[model samples]
Target: MFSIFNIHRMSVTKQLSFSFLVVIFIGSLLLSLPIAHCHNAPATTYLDHLFTAVSMVCVTGLSVFPVAEVYNGFGQVISMFLMQIGGLGLVTLISISYFVLNRKMSLRDQNLLQSAITYDSANNLKSYLFTIYRVTLIIESICALLLMIDFIPRYGLSHGIFNSLFLAISAFCNAGFDNLGGSSLQHFQTNTLVNLVIAFLIISGGLGFMVWRDLYHAARHFFRSKPRRLRAFAKQLNNHTLLVLETTAVLLILGTALSWLLEASNPKTIGQLSLAKQGLVSFFQTVTMRTAGFSTINYAQAENSTNLVYIIQMMIGGSPGGTAGGMKVTVVAVLFLLLKSEVRGQTQVTYRFRTVPRKIIRQTLVVLIFFFSVLLTAYLLLLEFEPHLSPFALFFEATSALATVGVSMDITTKLSTVGRIIIMVLMFIGRVGPITVIMALLQNRRREVTYAKTDIILG
Candidate 1:
């Protein structure tokens, strides 16, 4: 007979996947309770509750029902809790619990933690886990305080504080669930303070914990040493940090500029707003499209060009080891570099004078192929189930779900039961990652025989 402790014997990928599924199941049960619903709200089905639970636990905010209307305060809190667990990750939470209980982690436990968080080694696991929690707390606390400045006066003390905290967690987690009715942050489109605060939170969260740690150390070193030269400070940063920062900055600027250009003449989106306000909306959309689901404009009414732009942005998503989801910025960066190398007739992919390993290139290609395969399969299934929706609309929704971006173009509520289920599975897979799923299912077996390789003709 196997015991719960035997879970430690499972492979890291399986352990992590199983942990996420267990959490989602537990969340579903809790949300299905009668108290989770509003008193006057119509009777809700179990499947809907389960769907909402999965969405929250996956931190993919595609809800079958409007969260604000259907869930009461208790339910909303439950949703927030689920988001926290999902954002921090199940393995991280379990490690935190062990720390709180003063339980010494075994070698197997450390291996599990390392694999779950994709940490390179067990040597710095403790410090890394501590940093993750500490940074999350500090960032979320500051964001909540900043948000309270705007929310308190508007929604009153209790509700405002609750909303502030909820939004803070949701924003930092990239969960994108809001109780401010169904319009999202449309009312605050032009509010500089609110938009900027949320945008910063989202970007910080999406940058990944490793980047945050590097930046923090770099800042500390600069401040402590009082470096007289800028070069000294620049030397403190690593290549990974530089790459992530540069890629993120470029994506934000390009996404914002393209969105503005695409929607400038459209009456439904940024056209009606003043030039300054339009710029603000465009900037917000760019930030949110990176896997944070909050939106300032009606995405459903967005021009086809704008939708196409968002599809690309959403698919690229945030950095690895971050709260946000999608194929990841690093993966895309590797792919771009590989293409550039090939175009230049080079055999090795190099960035910033550093050669990217062949293993990394192969891994990126595998992830891309798996991502597209899943995306195509889901799109085909959705087309069969929802023949009424436009192809772009369905593709957008499918991409949003697979990216765990939670930004639907008004198609979520209209999805059929099967469609919703498909989206749920996609959200789970997206959050867990296609690679993780593949690893979980297939143990890494070593090949017993070596064979000669044959080359196939290429374009």
Candidate 2:
């Protein structure tokens, strides 16, 4: 049996795991309420309710049905709330709660916060937590105002306001839920302004809070400094920020080009559109694939090659500390750099005049091992459960769920209850990523015993 004290004494990892579970369960119950659905909406099973709750709380947006068709406005509010909390993270919310109560965080709480955030130190904790919330509210509010320009006439005053707010939160959080809900923003593909604003929100959220904090601090310094050169602002940013920015820029460009090249001639895709629309849609394809999950094109009808690229992009998702999930941009960047160095016969993994830490390499390995292990396990289980579906589709579904990308083949509604459960687990793991980050953040002590190095045969 579990006691309150025992629960309180649990480590940061366990607390996070338990916290997400609690939120999911509570959200499931709330969404299952009678008022949550329309009077004429088809009756849904608790599993479906649970699945939807997990989808929103995990910020995955892989619903088993059309959300707007089934759920009422009240349900949408509940879902938006879930997305907001999940995007901001449970730890950050808890910190906010403490702040509201005017409670001081214990040393244990500080350590937990540090481990939870993977921050270098937990000093000035209030400012950090406030900054995250402040930034989120400001961005989401601005995007909402911008979106209302288009949504107002289309949806009427009240509906437009709500829709704009919901869409804005969803986009910035990379949750991908849309009340418009025919083909997710496909109707707005030609609305370049709306698309661009959404793209900005997606990119901003996907960059992660670390970059946001760094940029915020940099801007502050630039304002205070005697000379305000842009380079000085950039100089204040650490290599990690630069690495994330560089990797993100490269992926977006390459992904956009690859999507355009592959799908430009596919009649089922953007091939019929004008060059400008095609380019815009292709750019959206790559941008949304960066864990935002909005689709301007029918992924079901997309070329196999295009889907392959999208899958890779989903797996190599947004940066750390943000709402986005996946193996993460930094992980891919470090591994690729490590490989490049190894091929060049360099002993040290050096990048931009800095050496990659040995600890980071080990942590990266742990993340990959944990990530791939779960991904493969889920893929195999999905294959067993969904034998009628193609292996490739299952792989795509598994990867999407594991990365919390939410883009799926037209098969989500066809999944069995057990399959949905599997997807829920994947979403839970992907968003929280305790298994991926826990071992890396755990405190390890130096071993007194020394052993001789052993050689192993390799390919």
Candidate 3:
């Protein structure tokens, strides 16, 4: 018989995956209860409940039913709870429980926690976990206060506070689930306060905890030291932090520029807004497309080019260790560096005068290939199940689901039952990560044999 300790013996990948699965199951059960739905809302099927549960637990905001119309306050609270746990991660919650109980974490527990957060080092794991939770709560609280500044007067104290809290958590977790009527921040598209607040929250959350730590340390050193030492502290930023910030900036600029150019003339999109609002919306899209699902514009009415741009952006999601999903910015950076090295006929992949290990390159390639494979499989199955929808819509939905980017083309509710199931699977795989899922399924057996290598012809 399996004991409690047996769980600790399981592989980190399996434990992580199982933890999410269990959460999804429990969330589905909670959501399926009648109290979770509105009294006047149409009767929801079990599958629909399961779908929403998976989406929430995966922090992918896709929904088959309108969140505001179908769910009452109770249901919304349940959804938020699921998103909270999912966003913070189960391993994180477990670690916190251990800390709260004053139980020392075993090395295995520390390793699993490190794996969940994608932190390279296991040293000082307890401190890092505390820091992560503290940072999350602080940021969410600040964002909630900022949002309440606008929401309190408009929504009243009770509703406004709830909205602020919901949006704050959603934005910080990169969950993208909003309680705002079905329009999802569309009404606030031109609202500067709403736009900037959500944008800031999304960016901060998507930056990942490691970057937060790096910035925190840098700030402390800079402030504590003499003016002459500021430059030295600035130079202390690690390559990962620098790479994430730089790539994020480039992607945001690129996404914004492309969105503006492609949709500037369309009356349904950015074209209908003032120049300043247009810029805001464009910038918001750039920020949100990196796996945050909030959207000010109707993506269904977007130009095909714009949709394609978002597809690419969603696929190359936020940085590693972030709440956001997709292949990750770091993988893209590695790929770019790899391409550069190959074109220059260099044998080693070098960045900032440092050589990237071959193992890292291989792992990046594997992750990229795995993501595409899963995406392609899900896309094809969705096409088969959702034949009535346009190919572009189906493709976009698949990509969004897999990337855990909840942006959709208004076809989510219209999808067939089987199509929704496919999306749920994709969302699950996406949240757990392609590599983790693969590792969980495939046994990592080591071979003692040393084989000679031979060169193969390349294209």
TM-score of each: 0.93, 0.95, 0.93
All candidates' lDDT scores?
A: 0.84, 0.84, 0.85
| Candidates 1 and 3 compared by lDDT, better number | 3
Model 3 clash count equals 0
| Candidate 2, 1-459: lDDT as tens digits | 887446556655666677778888999998899999988888798999999888887888788877787889999899998888877775455674467757556776676565556455547777777778889999999989999999999999999999999999999988988988757888897799799999999989889877888888899999999878998988999998899999999999999999999998987888899999889999998988888878888888998889999999998989887888888898999999999999999999988989998877877888888899999999999999999987888888889888988888878888998899999999999987743275335545545797999999997
Colliding pairs, model 2? none
Candidate 1: give its CA RMSD in angstroms. 2.4
Which whole-number lDDT from 0 to 100 does residue 394 have in model 3? 91
lDDT of 1 by residue, 1-52 (tens): 9776777666566667777888888888888888888988877788888888
lDDT of model 1, residue 364: 78
**Candidate 1: minimum summed lDDT over ten consecutive residues — where?**
437-446
CA lDDT, candidate 3, residue 281: 92
In model 2, the Cα lDDT at residue 89 comes to 74
